[model samples]
Target: MRVDAFDFELPQELIALRPAVPRDAARMLHVKGGVIEDRMVLELPDLLDEHDVLVFNDTRVIPAQLEGRRGEAKVGVTLHKREGLRQWWAFVRNAKRVRDGDTVEFGGGVEATALRRGDDGAVLFEFLGDEPVELLLERAGTMPLPPYIASKRGTDERDREDYQTMFAKEDGAVAAPTASLHFTDRLVEAIDAKGIGRETLTLHVGAGTFLPVKADDTADHKMHSEWGRIDAATAERLNAAREKGGRLIAVGTTALRLIESAADEDGVIQPFEGDTDIFITPGYRFRAVGGLMTNFHLPKSTLFMLVSALMGLDTMKAAYAHAIAERYRFYSYGDSSLLIP
Candidate 1:
């Protein structure tokens, strides 16, 4: 399909710069079987049944945005993936000034040598120290905010808490699973009281999620891989939930993608650990995930394509049109949507 088919005009003002205060106060658009309903995130517990299970991505966002100097030229680095104990794949700004083997010195005693460049333009970097990479980032890196928001306002102390979800535990992700950001302790308690089951998995969201689809056609676009894991116990529980006639409601696209990657042709989920470059597009049949709760996405983005695949293209276009007309916020810090096909 043509990538332009997923394009839509979004007013500049609609992009959200900050998450809604109280988080759960954010509006949610419920799109069920082509029907649209306006609701609030706090009402999510009432939206599903006792038998339904909500799967969450527990991958914590690390401070992956770094600014450094390679000799006289300034370079920006956003670590996207972990390659080893001290090696990472990063998207380097001002790549023209640096070469393979060149060392970039980030402040606070953090430094890394460029190993090589990938076909996707990301540079492989190995940190030049014995200390844990997480510690190095703590001293030098800031929260990796989505460019849409960061381009408008600088990242601050507020983002250190606001950008992370209450479920964040495992540290690896460069990006937060925005859908989970709307969740709060109060909301979780309400969900638990309603008997909605909850589960967790890990998917270290990479900076590639922010990359645009420059391809003319969907087939021409390539998705960068992101590491994810689903243990055998979790897989068994998820499969059993479905077998007992319960729906698996993925809390975000990260969980949805990981679960789908783990599901078989028969839709039974299995234990999985490794990278997933699952590119969901229209005409692709979903396997395990029954519903998805996610934030609004960019125009012509892979996320939009995934949502379009979940609901039909025409249905998603109409749903997005409704969202825009209703003035719901957009992007990572934007409003939420519950998609049930």
Candidate 2:
């Protein structure tokens, strides 16, 4: 399908620069079949049933943005994927000045050498020390905010806590699973009290998630790989929930994609550990995930395409129109929507 079909006009003021206070105070638009209801994140417990399972991505966002100097030239790097313990694939700004084998010196004595360039225009950087790269980043990096927000303002101490979710434990993601950001301990307790089961999996959302789709057609757009893992025990528990007639509610699109990638034709989820570039578009049939709770996405973005696939394209368009008209916030720090097909 044409990528233009997913395009919509969004007012500049609608983009959220900061998250709602208390997290659960964020607005949530419930899209059940064709019905739409405006609600708050705190009301999520009432929307689910005792037999439903909510799957959350436990991957934590890292300080992936680095500002460095290669000789006299300034280099901006956003680490997208981990190639090794000390090596990462990064999208570099001022790429023309950064050649392969050039040492980019970040502040506080941290440095990484450009090893090679990937086919997707990203540069491979190998850290030059024996200490863990995570430690190096702690000294020389900042949180990797989405460009939509970053372009408007600078990242600050507040974003360190705001960009991460309560489920954050395993560290690897460059981008936050925005949908999970709306969850708080209070909400989790409420859901648990309501008898809704919660499960967790890891999907290190990369900076590639922020990349724009420049293709005219959906078939031509390529998704950068993101590493994810679903252990056997979790898979078994999810299968058990399904056997008991419990619906699997993916907390975010990252969880939804990872589960769908691991599901078989029979709709059984299996243990998985690896990279997935699963590009979900219209006409794709979902198997493992029954419902999705996610943030509002950009125009012509893969996320919008995935939501369109979940609900019909026309349905999603109408839903988005309703969201815009209702003045719900948009983007990573924005409001959320519960999409049930």
Candidate 3:
């Protein structure tokens, strides 16, 4: 399929620079069975059932965007994917200047070396100090804001909260599990009171999630790998829910990818801990997810492709058109959509 086949026009005004005031006040577009219905995030309890189990990616967004000096030359790095506790695959602006063996020092003397460059234009990094990257990011890095957002008031505060989901606990993601942003404790209690269960998984959403489908042919585009994990306890409970004939719903594409990656051919899911570059395009067979909650994605992005895989391409196109006409917000910190496949 051509990547251009999935392209659509979105007004710049629709790209949300900030989240809605109260999280649950954001809109929700329910797409099911080739039909679309408008709704609100607070209506989650009414939209779902007792026999449904919602899965969320609890992978926290790290303050992974860092500004540091490489021998007095200005360099920006976004630590989007982690290889080991101290190693990472980072995207560097003006990366050509910082070739192999060069070191970048962050706040304090803590530093990381440019081990090399990868095939995908990512810089291979190995931290110089013995301390883990987790601590380093927390101490020196700022929340990695999306490129589209331009901040003037203060760059620090909004990103700290906006770029993280309410349920995020595990730290790894360079980006937030967007759909989970629309949720609030009140809404969660409502869902729980309605008898819907929620489970947690981890998928360190990387900066690659924002990469455009550079190839005109969507099939030719390569998907970037992201680390994910499912604990044995969560795996057991999800399997139990399946056995009880409960519907399994993934809260975001991150959770969807983790669930799909862990499920076996028999539709049984095992605990997982690894990276996945599973590009979910149209015609791909789905094994574990029965429903998905996600934000409107960029045109020709892997996310759009994933949504196209869930609902047919035509239905998604029409639904997006409806969203555009309705003046719905788009992207991270944007409104959400629930797809019942």
**For each candidate, how many residue pairs have backbone atoms clashing (under 3 Å)?**
0, 0, 1
Please provide, for model 2 over 73-135, each residue's C-alpha lDDT reduced to its tens digit, 9 standing for 90 to 100.
999999999999899999999999999989999999899999999999999999998888999
Candidate 2 residue runs with Cα over 4 Å from true position: none
Quote model 3's TM-score.
Answer: 0.96
Instruction: Report lDDT (Cα) of residue 122, candidate 1.
Output: 90
Whichever of 1 and 3 has more lDDT, that candidate is: 1
Q: In lDDT terms, how accurate is model 3?
A: 0.89
Give the C-alpha miss distance for residue 311 in model 1, angstroms.
0.9
Window of ten residues with lowest summed lDDT in model 2: 129-138
Per-residue lDDT tens digits for candidate 1, residues 226-281, read 99999999999999999998999999999999999999999999999999999999
Question: Runs in model 3 with CA error above 4 Å?
Answer: 150-154
lDDT of candidate 3 over 81-183, digit per residue (tens):
8887688999998897799999988876668999989988889889877777788888888888777664423357777987788888988888889999998
